[model samples]
Target: MSLPDFDTFRAAQAARGFDEVVARSWAPDEDVATHSHPFDADALVIAGEMWLTVDGVTRHLRPGDRFAIAAGTPHEERYGADGATYWVGRAEPG
Candidate 1:
């Protein structure tokens, strides 16, 4: 689904208690092999595109697109032809 602007996304994440927030960028055709995070997180694409695969399913994400991943869920990511930049927010465990 589409996401709000970067500032709004960050504010929402903060409001939701996401303690770790950062901006990340990927180069053209960059690929991240299967991996998992220790904490649940959400990402909001700010520029270019990304192809994200979670549990073997892939979806295209463009600017303003957002996605969430649960802790420990295996996933892979590939940047678009022109690469991408996004903001990620990690939630603290209760």
Candidate 2:
């Protein structure tokens, strides 16, 4: 199946029982509020750089990098000077 465009990605998330799905190009200094999810997540960095805080520990993610996060984890994100574009997936199995 073909991948959905960024505009329609969130709909896919809803269809799959995901709390949220985000896909966008971020600018430097962009910040995502700290939050917790109830399911597993996979994030892929498409360009630039970012720092993700997971359970109080921060991990840097760069282009071509991917990360998986477990359920019920608290996390937040900060963009780097060059910013970043990423695809984030969050889902719970039925």
Candidate 3:
């Protein structure tokens, strides 16, 4: 699903009570092996590009692009040539 701009995304997350938010930066061509989160997550790309593979579907995400990760869903990622930076919002545990 498509996502709104950064400000809107942040606001929505706040409204949903996502108290844990962080900004992360990846190095050029950085790769992350498959992993899963214990809680739901929302990631918004702020700079450069990211290639994300989730449930065997790969998506190329650029600035202003966003994606969601359900709890315990396996995913992997690769950064673009120029690297990337993004904001991640995590839902509070129930």
Candidate 4:
């Protein structure tokens, strides 16, 4: 199924009590250094690929893939050579 457009997600987020949505584009060789959050986070890949390292386990996620990162977990990410577009969901006011 086709994913909803950004506008649709933005509208939906606007109604939530605590929501933070990010439309992220990662360039080739880019890495989001390991970090931890106090709240839950989710990510949905739109294109290309990304490698998510959570608790020492690395998971490769490509287009149309979705995953959740538990709160307070240490995690990091890397983008493929072709880069990637992804949507992030956070439990925070955006």
Best by TM-score: 1
For model 1, state the Cα shift of residue 75 in Å: 0.2
Candidate 3 C-alpha lDDT tens digits along 4-75: 666776787888888777788999999999999898888888899999999799999998888888888899
The CA lDDT at 85 in model 1 is 95
Per-residue alpha-carbon lDDT of model 4 for 1-94, expressed as tens digits?
Answer: 6877877766665565337888989889798998988877776788899899988899999878988877888999899999999887778424
RMSD of each: 2.1, 4.9, 3.0, 2.9
Ranking by lDDT: 1, 3, 4, 2
For residues 1-94, write the lDDT of model 1, one tens digit per residue.
4557667778889999898888899999999999998988988888999999987789999987889998888999999899999999998566
Top candidate, metric lDDT: 1
Worst 10 residues of 2 by lDDT: 1-10
**Which tens-of-lDDT digit does each residue in 29-93 have in candidate 2?**
89999887777877667778999998789989887677878877788989999889987778774
Each prediction's whole-model lDDT (CA) = 0.89, 0.78, 0.87, 0.81
Deviation in Å, model 4, residue 71 alpha carbon: 2.5
Q: Candidate 1 vs candidate 2: which has greater lDDT?
A: 1
The segments of candidate 3 whose C-alpha lies over 4 angstroms from its true place after superposition are 1-9
Model 1 residue pairs with clashes: none
Native-to-model Cα distance after best TM-score fit, residue 15 in candidate 1, in Å? 0.7
Candidate 1, run of 10 with poorest lDDT: 1-10
Between candidates 1 and 4, the TM-score winner: 1
